[model samples]
Each structure stands twice: as structure tokens, then as C-alpha cells.
Target: MEQQKLEKLLSKMTLDEKIGQLMQFAGHFYATNNNKDPVTGPDDLQVSSKSINYSGSVLGSAGAERNKEIQERYLAQSRMKIPLLFMADVINGFRTIFPIPLGLGASWDPMLVERAQTISAKEASSAGIHVTFAPMVDLVRDPRWGRVMESPGEDSFLNQEFAKASVRGFQGENLQADGERVAACVKHFVGYGAVEGGRDYNKVDLSERELRENYLPAFQAALEAGCELVMTAFNTIDSIPASGNQKLMREILRKEFDFDGVLISDYGAVEELIPHGVAADQKEAARKAMYAGVDIEMMSLCYENSLKELIGEGKVSVDLLDEAVLRILNLKNKLGLFENPYRGASIQKQNKYLFCPEHKEVAQEAAEKSCVLLKNNDVLPLRGGKIALIGPYADNPDILGEWSIFGKKEEAVTLKAGIAKHTSDYTYALGCPMYDRQETALTEAVNVARESTHIILALGEGSDRSGEGRSRSSITLPENQLELLRELKQIGKPITVVLFNGRPLDLMEVAELADGILEAWHPGSVGGTAIANLLFGKANPSGKLTMSFPRTTGQIPVYYNAYNTGRPLPEGSTERFYSRYIDTPNEPLYPFGFGLSYADFQYESLQLSANELKPGGSIDVQVLVKNQSDYSGEEIVQLYIRDLVGEVVRPVKELKAFQKVFIPANESKLVSFSITEEMLRYHHANLEFKSDPGEFKVLVGSSSTDLLSQSFYLK
Candidate 1:
């Protein structure tokens, strides 16, 4: 189907049919005849079955047999026989679960992230999914928000790079390619990550400059990578909800960014405009969202009930309605759905692709790469010692994080099972429940620890504690788990802590109690196997933290790239008058790009090709990295820069580029990075993006806080 055919089909649609194309609902509404209870409708509104038959798309529907039935029923009723599109929230993986997005970000490998998405696309498309509301490119700095599990991390550059990789992974070279590919939808359009108090669906208030500087780059990166759709955020931007903000949707996204993709609202966001004090009724809500460039209403009744009335009263133009309908038709044509209504959906294909052996292999490799070693002593690599694995998460299979809607927990391997394959001289005990301390459980754990040579304490939040409407005010480990650690410390054995979580946690107490710590954040189905491999030296830990772990929860919004304040405190100063905390240090317990490997790495001898850079000229910065220990390993060499003087105040340090290299035992390798003028550009006070002529500092190191520095000038 071509553009001319799509336009011809659009011209033949009636007003009611066109309105139906813009409405989306769950598949259950049409799968069954009993509408006694409203299926996913707003509390005050009840959608008729007639509207379900005429709706253009369905959400949360899968399986080839089920989708084929619904499509046959819908096409028989639709006057134009337009096929219904299917969408779902395939965030990380569809059937074969991979590590959560946060864990994948810690790997610092965009190519691996892209490969995960490619597998995700293949599995989902075979199950009859056409679009996935995934690659959530929101930049999050707060760990209390449950949705942080879905984001990449705090840095703008890292999130921007992962955003492009996610788009290429999902959509591939073209959506109509032969492999399993679905259209990618970049979500939460503007500033949903900076909600006040780190609460979910809370109000977001920020300056225009702050919004452009930090939150908007990832979405821009997604659009530049050719994402086909955008989803509006649930929170308000500058006092106007994203679904009703004309300046944000029209000026910044449509005209400035030139994003001509279909814009859809977050779940039931259009109807909530009345409660937001921006609209008087459903009629007003539909009108405002349309004028703000929202092409489709998701799981809401405002558009179905009020759009026709608004058009009849001359309040809404027919041209605007046609424009929205045309975009939907054009996407359908692009997907080649007009020719093949089923779009390659078949039971044979679903069985052949979902949870296959090849998919499981990729999941295992991703789980291995995502494990980050935060601390280590000589107690690791338990080659011959008897081990004690004590915790509720030891034998539990609920390690899959939240938002994995289709994953089965029973299929996941347990930690006890993974370790049992390596050694038979291991004992297991359930120390306590995840959130509470039980006396009998602790007594048994102590007995097991007393008889063992080393203790591996596995601890973390429950699977339901993070992701989508599960925000927490405190990010510390549970008190009972800490108490368990305290009791186990009395046995006088080396303790290695393994954490299973969804977000960054304050580990001030855990760091003091344990000799070794590994952050294994919900490493999907093959999590236990990956942890076992890392524990026994079969694979070295190569992951680095993408988000900073604060020393305390009071330092809520902390990151590596923060602007320098005028009244900054001096280094190692404890002065009360300066900008320093009275009781705690002003730094994170674990900084961004911080991780430890079994092999020791040293950075030395920084050299620059030129001391000054002019227009159209590039400079090469080189550093030598060596593995001092007798074990081969991989290192992530990070490059950061700071503009000493600029038109606008810049951050203390900003990560510009990085390279992940492998070094043999006791061998040295030279890492080089090319610096161009494009990497130094920033948005000025007038919103113009350009670099200024000034002195800049170039820093090279393994982590943000520990660096070797040099100076150069940009002319």
C-alpha cells in the first residue's frame, strides 16, 4: 500500500469510523460478549460494545490464535475492513527475559543492549505484537521512584547512546524487514523522571533551561534514530499536563524537533485532565489533547464520547480529525498490514521463537555481563572452601524484576541450584523473610554459618517492590536483613553480600559489615547461573554503575554531572560555613562508572596531540592502561571534560566518551579518543546550541571521583 492508497482509504471513512480509529482498548472487551463489568474504562464512563467493534487497535493482547480471532471479528464488522494493530509493554524481553534495563545500562555495552532488543523484537512480533512501548529513555537521578528500573541511568550522554541503540534494536533497518521487528515507541515524552519527592505520577516542576539541559536529550536521540511513535508523560510540565501542553508538544516536539510520528497519551491520561484543573469535562479534555497534538487516546473514553459533539458544534475542525486519522493509516501501510492482515502471526512461529535455546543463551550472556562487583576481599573465588548460602532469595525464583508481564518465575534457576553445579560442599539456610526478622529462621542461619568456612549473604527487595506505582520513601536495605548480617558477623568468617534489587540502594551499613559485595539487580531467568560463574572466576565482573549510590537518602537527587555552585566547599574541608553536610560527606558511596574486577588495572601517562583545538580540527587524547594482577580482565576507560569558563555555568564534570577494552594478565594497552568541536556544544541562555572559546580540563580515569587531569584550550 502506498501513500495514495492510504489517502484514498482515509477519504472513504465516515466520521464515526474515523473516530473509532483513534480509540484503543483492551482485547478482552471484544473477545467476550459479557460487558456487565466495564473492561478498563474510566470510572464515570462505560464504553459500548459497538465502539469496541469499530476501535482501531488493541493493547495487551498476544498469542497468534487469540489475535487471529479478534482480527477476523473486527474486519467482518469494520466497513473498510481495516486490520486492528496490537501493542504491549515489552520493556526488556517478551518471553526469554534479560536483565532489567538498569542492569543492562551498567554493562556499558550498547552493542549488547542492541542485541537484547533484537531478540525481544523477534519473540514479540511472532506473538502478534506490532508495537512495543519500550526503550523508556527517561533520565532518572532518584532511586526512590519505582520506574527507575526501566530507565538507563543519570547521565545524559549514556542515556542518549542507549536510546539510539534501543530504537535500532526494536525497529531494525526497517519495520518491514523479514526478521521479528516491531515499531518502537519512546515514552514519557518530557520531564516525568524529575517528579517531586521521587514519587510516581507526582507533579514535575523545573526551569526551561534545566529541562532542555538534562531531560530532553534522550527523547531527541530517539527521534533522530527514527522511532515511529511517542507517548506523552502522565505528569505536568511547567504547570500544564503533557497531554494538554501546546507549547511543549507543538513548539518543541513538532516544529523544532521535526517529529512527525504518531503521538499517543499515557494510559488514561486524557480523562485525568479534568482532575488536573485544566479541563471542565470530558469534552474539554478531548479538545485540549487534540489541539496539543495527541493523535490517539489510550484506554480512555473522553475521545469516543465527546469528539463528535465537539465537531458538530463547530468547536473542533474536521481537518484536524482527518490529520490524526491519516497518521494512523500511514503507519498501517508502512507495516504492510494492508496486504497481510495477520502480519506473520502463526502458532508454529510462536512456538519456534519463544523461549528457545538460542534466546536463553543470549539471556545468560547478558546476565553475566550485567553483574557489577562493588567490593571484594580475598574471600571470593571459593575454589575449595565449604560455602554457606543464607537468605530468602537463595532458593527463591522471584528474581525477575517488575514490568516483566509475561515471564514465568518457576522457569528461573535458583541461586542454590546454580551454585550446586559448581560444588557439592555447600549448605543453605533461609536467614529471614525479605522485610521481617524471624527468630527461628535466624537461629538456623547461624547454625549453618558456624559450620561453614565462608558465608554468601543474598539479600534485596521483593519483586513487587519496584516498577510502576511502587515508589518508596526510603532506599536502604531492610532492617531485618541488616540484623541478619550483624548476627552472621559474629561467626568470624569472611562474608560476601550479593544484592538483588531494581534501583540504587544506600549501602552505608552493608559496606561496613561485608568483605565483598556484588550488585546483581534482577538478572532475569539466567540470573543464578551468571552469579555462580562470577563467584567461581569463570567470568570476570565488567559492569559499572550508571547511577550514583548516595551515602544517605537525604541526598536524593545526586549525579556525576551537576553544575558547580558559587559557594563550593574546599577539598577535605569540614567548615560549617561552607556548602558541606554537617554529619555526612558530600559524595556518593559508589560513584558513577565505579566497579571492581578481579584483575587490578592502573592508568598512567596522559598525552595530548595538541594543546589547542580550532574550528574543523580534532585532537587525540591517549592513555596507557595495564592489568597489574595475574588475571585477564576487561576495563571501561572513561573520558570526561569540563569547561572552566563558559557563557552559562557548566557541570563539574561531564562524560563525553568511553571504551571497553580487554587486557591480558600483566599486559598494557594504549586507549585513544578523538575529540571534535561537536562534543563541546551546549545550549546557551537563549537556547542556541554552540561551544564557547575557553579553557577546558580533560580528565581520564576509571571512575568519576578518581581521575588524572590535564588542560587544553578551545579556540
Candidate 2:
């Protein structure tokens, strides 16, 4: 009945109304060069304002009062009295901030991720936000890519689970029925993560097989989760930009996938097509983007100016205009905006839920689980030591990184504070600025490091250095910081390096110099407490790397799950054509699904209940994991599979399933994973998902690069 009403209303809408529906302008705010937008009101048109026309929707004008004011303006001033669809970049939080998505992924718990996003939606929707730009389901492989922190790591299956959970979390049971929930958008459709050289906004060129196999799964998973909106990528899929690629946005995303949701553009992505040289100008960029299926223009006025002229010149069809408007109206109707344009106007509720205690508790847990122990040499669990906490990030709260829109840095517990709470005597040195190259400052840092019993070197790229538009050609640690570490190592104290980077850095120096290294990738509000907990033996580090850490920027676009070339390497042979790199090893500094704990875990005795299985048959594969170390800690035992040969030439290995287990000192548990025929299936040459009857090797291990294996057969 609601669908019928939407259709009838859409059909009755005049060409101007349809065009108005298709057009979306930025709210009275702008993201400056620094990627931060200043808060503004609807009437504050000093920057640049639309002519009081109800262009289909508005973006970035969140908050209960702000959205209500915008809706009121739309209702009273517009010729057609249509309510505007309100959207905001509710990435991780609206009021209460959680750990970044990568940190949340470390928990390896989908339900937890869902709950966090659910809380985010509850807070966002209560504040008059009808839609959230969330579930950035880009399949990231490059750890150097700043936005890796925003994604659910590099695994397709894991990403699928998180994507689905996030959609359910955001939209709740149903948009129309759940008035407090907002519409969720799965973003950066089709290969935004595989940017060349791990640089943001770079090109992507992968075979179609790779795209369907690895890249597109999460996006499809989001759609399956009942997501009402899709945001196109800023990067190119093939030769064309994703925002303007009709084949991707129209032919595949719409025609083939049958996605009926409104396809919104990334922030200024439609306008960027002009700079991409595909579109001659902003007018052509707008025409191409709309024709390619972008329903809403985010932070770009190109659509508002170009759409009317394009339709008048017959450059764009009126039917497509109607379709775009209808989709927007359909989403608005589903969100119950027609019934209550100010549904989210609840200042009392916002005050209640924003930075709630329950949300902070969850954020702490997420932060704790997300702190990946990259390397430990019995230097951690710092129970009794005169520790020297040295770094610009040690006492600074701004190291919380980007997309933490609502997160108050002042509220963030600094590592210095957390350490002080845990230990009695500690000295903190500002050291060199995160990206600064000063040696005089390093002398003071070195003096402080030498005075302490142990030096805790907080290192890596600053928060401002690793987000979108903050891309760097060099991903190595700053020279001065590296020099400070080198000097600290000379002190001969047990040096523990705690990294507060937004993305993976080339930490070969710190990895070699530091006695212990903790990859604490900008864990959110409770990050300091979480790091302290892990350092003081209060909490175990169970977090794993979602993306591979590249040895160098040159060896980028690397992942554990990759296809074997025709010239396959024969084990134990150093042949030339067997898919080998002469200069560099075909491995990462740290592989995906990799992490460490204070305790050591030994995996032994791989047991399989059955060797052969059919489509419906099930097999139980078990491995005994013993905590050899004195410390009690948790370990995530990962399961992977490899088909020796296939019609499509499958990856050398693929992650199938995993289980995170906690073990007490000197205890063992038999971890088991059940496999069915569905788990073995994949897209064939015809792109159909089915498993072939063949021998398969099952690998069980702590990380992708370190595994123990056994064989099985599907018959």
C-alpha cells in the first residue's frame, strides 16, 4: 500500500517537481580543505544558499533542531510543499562515539558491531537524521590506505557479515515501522579500496572475475541487509570514475543487481568527474552522474544547476529524472518523512543518549579487543616499571583520528592519564611532533627515555595524516620520530612501541628496534584505557589486522587471499616464472588476521571427523590450542581453505571461518569449526556460486601467513 502511494505520488509529480526530487544540494555547511565542516544553521546562507527550492534532499545538516528548521523551510518556502530527506555522515557515531570500524572488527563479533551501529542509529535518528552515510563496505587490502580504519578489514566474508549487521543495526526491523531508526547507506560501491599504491583517490584496474569474487560481495551483502541507499565511489572502477561510470552504476548496480534504492554520490564526487577529465565541465559531470544513476548530489551544487538545463536540452531523459525522484520519494516515504518531517526532533532524547554510559562501556570493550599486539618480547604487561611515555600522541587527545565527528577529544582518556592510573612513577615527554623532523626536540626525548626503566614509544602517522585527502605518497614513520626510537633503543631499556596511527605504517624500523610493538590503530574514546589495560596485564589483546601491513609502499595492493597465476610456483623450487618477486618477498610486514597476546598459544593435533563430504554433508575439524605462556590471554584461531586446482584458478588460500577463544594459564581447549558444502562454494567461470568436487587443504593457525594444514575431499 505504501509502495502504491509512492508510485502514484511520483507519477503525479510535475517535471519541475521530479527534477527537484532528483536534485540535492549541500546544507548550509561546507567541508573545508581540512575535511572538517563547521556547524551552521539553515538561514545562514553566507557561504552559498539554494533558492529555497526543495531539491530532492539535503546532506550534512544533522542535529534535531537543524533538521527541523530545514524541513520547515522546505514545507513553507517551496512551490510544492515537499519535505526534504535529511542525511548526515553518521559513520561511527552521532553523539556517542565507538571504536573505529577496524577496531570493532577485532572483536570478531558481528552482534557487537551490530549493537554499536544500532546505538548509533538510535542516537542519529533521535537527532532528526533520517539517513546515515555508513557501512563503508569497501574491500580494503592496502593497510596504508587511510580509510582502512573505516572498513571491516580486507576479508570478503567478514565484510559481508559486518555489512549485513550494520544495515540491520541502522535500519532496525523496517524503516517505515521503526520511526527512531534511520536509513543506512553502503558506500564506495565497486573497488574504492584497491586504490593504486595504497594512495587515496587513486585508480583501480582489476579483472571482472576479481571484482565479482572479492570487491562486490560486501555491497551485495549490504543490499541483502535491506539497506535503502547506496553511495557511489570517489575512485574509478575501470577507466572511468565510479560516480560517472554508467556500466557500474547503471548496468551492473541497477540493471543486473536490481537495486531500486537511491544511488547517492560521495562528497563532491560527481563534481570531481570534471577534474577526472571524463566530463568537460561541472555541467557535463552532473549530466553524466545523474544519467549514470546518481540520485543525490552530496556537497555539490552541480546537479541543481545542470539537471534543469540537461533535461531541457534532451541530454538527460525526463523518465530517468522521474525515476531518481521516485526513488528518493520512495525512501522518504519509507522513512515516514511525509507523516513526520520532524520525526527526529528530540533534543531531550539526544541529551539522554549522547555519550551515554552504556555506549562508552561498549566503546571501551571494542577498543580493548581492537588493540592488536603485533609483537611482544616479554616486555609488556608492565606491572612494575618506571615507564617513560614519550610521543606527541601520548598526552594528546586529537590522535583519535578522523570520522569521529561527535567524539570529544577532551573526553578521550590520554595514554598518559591511563598509565598514571595504572603505575605510580612515569615520565612523559612530548618528543617530536608526529610528523615533524626536529632533532633538538629528540635530545630531550632521549634524555627522558634513558632516565626511565622502560620506554613506551608511541609512534606512527598522526590522526590528520591518514584520512581522506590526507593521503601520503610515503607511508613510513616520520624520520625524526624514527631517529628518536633509534636513540631510545640505545638506552638499552625494554622499549615497547604503541602505535596510534590511523592506517598501517612502514614500521620496519620500530619493529626491529622496539622490544614490543602494539598496533593500536586509533582506538576511539576509551583507547587510552584499552592500551593501558593491555600493557598492564589487565586485558588481553585479541585484535587482529583486518588489512595486510605492507613491507614497503612499493609492495602494495597485497592481500592474503589472492589468485595464483598460470605459472604457479612449485613448492621448494626457485623457478623464475612461478609467480615470484625477485627483489621483494611476496608477503606483508604482517599478514591479515594477524595479532599477538602476552601469552603464547600452541596449536596441535588437527582432527577431522570425516575426510569426505557431499553438498549436504557436514565435517567437524578441530585443533587443540594450549596457552604455553604464564599469562592468561585470548587467541583467534583462523580457518582457511585452498582448492588445488579449479576452473577459475582460485586463490592460494581463502579465509573460511574463525573462532576467538580465551585460555587460562597452562590450559588447552579443542577449538572446532563445522563446514558444510555451502562453505566450499564460489563463483564459477559462469559467475554462478557452486562448489566443485575436489581435494581441499584446510589450514588452521594464528595468522594467515603462519598456518598448520590438513587435507580433505568433497565428493
Model 1 TM-score (2 dp): 0.98
Tens digit of per-residue lDDT, candidate 1, span 358-474: 988888889888889999987776667889999978888988889788778888877888999899999999999999889999999999999999999999988798999989999
Candidate 2 is scored at a TM of: 0.92
Worst 10 residues of 2 by lDDT: 30-39
Q: lDDT tens string, model 2, 268-345?
A: 788899888899887899888887999887766677667888889999888878778878878888887788778766
Q: Which residue pairs in candidate 1 collide?
A: none
Q: Give one clash count per candidate, in the order shown.
A: 0, 0
> Looking at candidate 2, what is the lDDT of residue 72?
75
